[model samples]
Target chain A: MVSALTCLFTPLLRAAELQSSLIASALWSGDSHNFKRQSHQFSLEPEAILRFDNRVKLTALMRLRSISFDGLAPQRVSDAAYSPLGKPLYMGNSSEFELREFYLELPSDNYYFTLGKQQVVWGKADGLKVLDIVNPQSYREFILEDFDDSRIPQWLANIETNVGEWDAQFLWIPEQSYHVLASEGGLYAPTSPLLLPQAPPVGVSVDVKAIDRPGRLLMDSDIGLRLSRFWKGWDLSLNYLYQYDNFALLYQDRSLTANGPHVTIQPQYRRTHVLGGSFSNAFDNWVLRGELAYFSDRYFLAEGLSDSDGITKGKEVSSVVGLDWTGLENTLISGQLFQSVALNRQSATVRDKSESTLSLLVNHTLLNDTLELRLIWLTNSNVGDGLMRLRVTYEWQDNLKTWASSDTFYGSEEGIFGQFDDNDRLIIGIELAFE
Target chain B: MKYPRLLSCWVGILSTPFFALTGLAQEPLSNAQATLPTGGQVAAHINSRDEGEAVSRKLSIVMRDKRGKTRKRETMSYRKYYAGEKRTVIFYLAPKNIRDTAFLTYDYNTPEREDDQWLYLPALRKVRRISAADRGDYFLGTDMTYEDIKLETRVSTADFNFKTVGNCDVDGHPGLHIEGTPKTQAIARELGYSKSLSCVDRQIWMVRQSQFWDIKGALLKTVTIANIDQIQGIWTQQNINVENHKTGHSTSLSFAEVDYQSPVPDTMFTTNAIKRGL
Candidate 1:
């Protein structure tokens, strides 16, 4: 399918002095847990890119993952055994394989257009908020189960135009669906149930009844405006986004009731509306950024639910503020504070819990950008827990690229009659991208 | 913004010559020797002076391809210096990612002249040396080449026939307009300005503007001196506008702030400085 289009477009690109290239890379990682259990993984990521004289570009990316773990059979091993989310998980390896990005872009003198499967980030949340953009859902994750599979629209089209000092964009998602949690053996059974520390970890189950029948096609649209200007030695940017989605209603009808070792819930459909604003400014080697978002009712609604009473109505507001200082030429220090609150609840029936997080990060470069070091300290106010992560990366162009990191989580609650000891996880990997 | 203000001031200064020579009566000289030598020397001196000083504080240059889309580049640098027995650096500054890069030229007049350059990288805490022949190449990533910033005296070795066109006000300052043309083919072809015309201020003998033309007499670039300010008794141009007639793309440099007489240590221009990280 893509070959025919490429053939048709090749002559036009050649006439326009455009260029295209393809790159393939492989990455491998090995890890040992408590100096005992060990795992090894490998992945292949291939990408093709096209560049036009007018700065227009198109890119397609594919990723394949294969992993193996010692001391455990493949059927017996699950993501829950390694982390909180009881789903199949892999860093650089996954049993599933899929396309990452298949997007086409047409950037002209004054405007740009993009259409296809792609990731769109609205705000700067890094990886610690409702809007955190740590990873986009890959094709493999679509066929498998992973907590990282949050949102990936099947069809999307976006247009951006600049008028004077203002840059505006309008995005349309004709069909969007959240990945359904794969059933362990049944057609649509919930694999892992949300369990409290006192609950049994294995046999405990959840019965999620589809009120509106889970997966329904819905339309979503977002409009954004950004104003960029320079003032007194500072570069300032202010932006706003308004989003509307129809799938919100479905997600609202879902509810979970804990009954001994079993739980049952119904998923409903609801309308979702979101409004957000952000500001970023840089002055005298200092950068300050802030963002606020308000989600109305059905922020993450699934499809097919009963909205007869419309009792499930509320709003969620999240805000984040960050500051970065670049006093040293090769070093940077940054910190961010984030808070999320559920507002205007329908009644006391809805439990409104606010989550606050603080993060501190420091980064430095060495050996002329060949080596880099990053350290992050994160604390969650609601969970009364802290996490520290340290990562070191080394790159020698096409020769070798390696990244080693360790994450330590503290204050984890006891689970299933066993104390959840602090987790000290370490990962090291190398990537080769030559030829 | 500063360049615009200085440009208006220069326009005022150049306008005076148009009125003074045509409006006021002046004695006409009959002997060619009486007017040629001094007038030619003054013309050359003015042109040389304007080219000698580095004009501009910081400039944002946008280079677009034939399709009018700007290209993204990692870095760009510009440097200028005076030519003499004792060399003096006129300007040494690179933008953003190219900062801390420096270039030095020696024996600028001779064919065997040499230029040594270096770039300091903060991440490595080291400076790397560059070859002299690279002068003709693009400076870092900008469209302007190293040769563009370094004045080539061989181009101005022509035996010039100078005639005072008139007096005019340039940026509100009074100045004279003198036209010079090469007397011999050797000088004409060497300078590449055989058919070009230059306007000079009589008092300071500073070339305020120069209009270049191709061999076929088509206009190329009209480089106008936009600002001339006095610094430590030495007149320096603070702004310049190079307008390409064909492309309609113009680059303007305005020196928002400058220190002309600042004590620049000799050690600062050494290869050691580049190695030790500028």
Candidate 2:
């Protein structure tokens, strides 16, 4: 898709003012579960910009990543890469060297158009995403990775223009990318009890006979619109999106045994509608932000269901409130409270019907802003599961830095984060930038 | 997306002038108010040649430590003037990591309200309003504080007594010497300065050299301006060097690609411009 755009915009950009930059980083991680190398990763990122006559700008980014696990013979290290290969009918993940952003922006007096692959952020929440759902996520490395690396870009066209002091934007997305989930048997996989009837046969193999992917038909695409305004130093925005669920839903095909049934789950996609809005206000050393979203026709896996009929449709409402403060000389503290509620639904598949989450981030820089220490903590209230990450970095030069980091997860195995409790890790990394 | 911790540094740097420049351009001048042209009026006159002037320039910021070791940053910047209303915006250019960061400021003539300021964070893809200003904190890891670059025009009238102290020479150019004494001892202490003196070149009417005395009545800093050039008939200083005697450190701000009195756009002063990174 990007290649096609490049071909079309090439002639216009050939003589454009050119600029480029490259950022490279490598990381080594060891785990507490077993004192062994848990991850080896190398990443090369390059960004290019071409500006023509001050009217159009093309910005592109390419990310090349290579990751491998410590396959120590004595003991196999648990890792996402250790997952079992998917069934015959599957959407595989081999997207290294992918284009993170390849978009051309055309700006005029009052309107602007952005076309090609891009990430459009729509919400004001921090850590907990409520309405910033314009792009899918890559969770192959779990949620420990920054969203910039996790966000999956889509091919789209965005048109924005102003009306008085208000701004209006329209988006049309033609391509959809699925969220990158962890492989089957990777270290971050569900352990003991989460190995249930659905994820059964933990050590066994499963076969897929059929699959369903997001449609490419124009009528079957995603569309969105947003209107925003800043009044009295406060921002207010309203957004609406008609799109598909980022992940797949499965339907069991049971006909193998008489009376007793063998289930063959068939993966499929569902359509959804999202309506949300955000607000933010900054006052005296602190900025407050909040987002509220409502989802219609949202699908949920029927708890304890054996057949593909497990996918049930329901409605949900989610909200997040966050604040960032810099009252101190070299310190910043931020926190957010997020909550989601399953609307009273016809589907009996709903379990608790409600969930709450909390996130906290603290950052401080010292030594003439050359050294920084940051910590992020997030937890699920209902399941009592939480994840904590810490990083300490010191700048060696204006464009070079080194850091040590750690990740810890704990709680009931029933929680998303708690399932990876045993996969706690420590990492060391360095990154350098050049232009 | 979670923003990189270091990105906050750029955010801080972008907000410095926007918040500090509040009411700085509107010096509220009246030819009759004083026995002589006041500091506010004089500083305002030196800052520009006409209203509604636009400028595009390349700025170099160099920071030096006690031992004279230096660190530098370069920026591509544009300033669009809003007539009657005092407003300006600056955009960063180089240092790949900090590129495209922008700052927008709206200065008001009214002393009752603070300036309207905003910072655009590329990583967050959001333009946020900045409501607070820390006058004492350093700007972008540089030796200069926000108050220093703010020009102190808004407070010049009420906080200090200005007078033509004497005749002085700067860089071999003849100039009128101007001395400012704090109106009160407490006001002097709050500003961390006992007194300030500036030598304004007679031809350009802009300060050629300035000296600051610390709270203890000792030399705290000395600033020298050099390389006078005429860009669009405006006498512009090409290089400014500020040395802090107490810290034994210094900072130099140099300007290039000077374009004065160019056509200015009204939209350039808006928040949308910041988000566009223009």
Candidate 3:
């Protein structure tokens, strides 16, 4: 079927007009405290875009990655993270040959149509997630990679049209996919106490059941709509999404059987309705951005030591306001303040009623932007846990770059960043691309 | 696209090898351009000249350092007029890393009205609103400032105090030399320039060369225009080069495939168009 379609479309596209790019990179990181080897990663990505005179466009991307720890033999990695319905082809324990994005765009007079396996992004926040959750993400690297690299593409249909002075986007995602988490024994697996379950009692045994993933085609699909307009000097947007939450909730059932106090744990995704709005405006050399969202029926883990279900439900509101200053030469300074609050808090809910975080970013370019320096700091106000990253990148030539970076996490064991404090590492990588 | 009053002068200035003010129907200078034109008259003449109703072209920008290492960026640029306001959009076409990135700007003729700009980054799949007030900042790692790229041969009459100095000759073309100083300290700080000297070709009424001084009163850079062409009966600047005197860095721009008669739609100047890429 694929070859037939390619043959039919081949004559319409000029060979010379097909845009292609190939990128190869090698990265190595070590434990900052122990100075021990952590992981070495190598990746290759090849992408191609074909455009016809009739305005039809096609894009395809293939990615290959291999990761090993301390130069050891490749470990057997499970494919559980991928959606069962749209899993890509895997080759050995360390290799994956996947068609990440194979989308065709059909544009009309005032409307645009895109269909296939693709990623759609919607939000105004920088380095944060709010209304940008149209597609699921991969936590394999724990939010360290650029969002473009971490967002998992899905089979979906997108339509964009101009309505009066506003732009409207409609999305229909049939692929049922959730967050891809790191393998239990993988290098980036989380060991944070807050995220882990308590140890079973001395006399009790714990049994974990397989994740109950939604498999229905139409009933379990995701849909979204976004409308944006530029009025006066401000850019404003309204967004809505009806879909399953990216993260699953743990449901526990306890019973006293012949095995004596056996606990069964099941993970299931819950549906939620999200409504949000964002606005941005620039004043002189400073730009102000803000986004707020309301989530209905979010699930949280219970704090009670002896709870039957170990789950709590509540409504939540998340908001962020940011500012960017470009007054300095070749330098950009940005700061954001974010907060999330649970409206109807439960007495036994493990999650706090209100949580706040602050992020600061500074980027400076030197030597005609050949050499770049960047610093990112994110701190949680309530927990005093935060992450800081300092990086330097140099452009050796066109489409070639070399970079070095250090990631440091601080906090107590139970805190989010504190859980990875010992995993701090320095990374050095070189990437070269050919077009 | 032709103004009858300026047609004779434009034809003679562009078709000839030299822009000499000799042997032409000696038309009297307008009130603004008296026997000795003031600096404002020269600036106004350059800004009001008719380039085209709409223009599209492929622009190549090359930057070189003291060590002779160079980087080149190529883009497709489109400019159109909406009512009296001007709108421009540029899309990057080469260098795979930055490909699919686009920038859109809406420039207002009224100096007091702030211009609106947006940059679409493909990597982030987001369109960011950017301020146009940082006109003095260098653009895309090039020696040319944002203002230089925004206003090619025109001068910002509101920001500067212009005075006619004397007669000057550049590249064998007789021209008028004008000196400009910032109108106020705030303007100087915003423009990052203390003083400027410009040479305007008398016949064509276009800036041929300009030298700038930094805010600290030190020689900053020199920009020279070349390869003037008459495309569809409109005078266009095809080649521009700027050299930073203090940093020993330079940038050169060459416009290719220039077209003024092509149909450039108003929709192409919108944010949605840029987000779609070329």
Best by lDDT: 3
Instruction: Output the worst ten-in-a-row residue range by lDDT, candidate 3 chain A.
Output: A70-79
* Listed models, DockQ each: 0.02, 0.32, 0.38
Candidate 2 lDDT over residue span B52-124, tens digit each: 2566667787767776556667765555545444665667676765666676666555544555666676767
Give the per-residue Cα lDDT of candidate 2 at A103: 92
Candidate 3 lDDT tens digits, A146-165: 89887889999999998998
lDDT score at residue A345, model 2, on the 0-100 scale: 59
Comparing 1 with 3 on TM-score, the higher-scoring candidate is 3
TM-score for chain A of every candidate model?
A: 0.71, 0.87, 0.94
Instruction: List model 1 lDDT by residue over B101-184, tens digit each.
Output: 444333244433343333333222222222333332333333233334444211233245666554544555555455556666
Q: What lDDT, from 0 to 1, does candidate 3 have?
A: 0.77
Residue pairs of candidate 3 with colliding backbone atoms: none
Error (Å) of candidate 1 at residue A38 is 2.4
The model with the greatest DockQ is 3
lDDT tens digits by residue: candidate 1, A200-311: 2566575555444223334333444544333332333455444433222322222334544553444444445556666555444456767777776533211113332324
Alpha-carbon local distance difference test for all models: 0.44, 0.66, 0.77
Candidate 1 regions exceeding 4 Å error are A1-10, A16-33, A53-55, A70-94, A130-154, A179-206, A210-263, A268-270, A298-313, A347-352, A414-423, B1-278
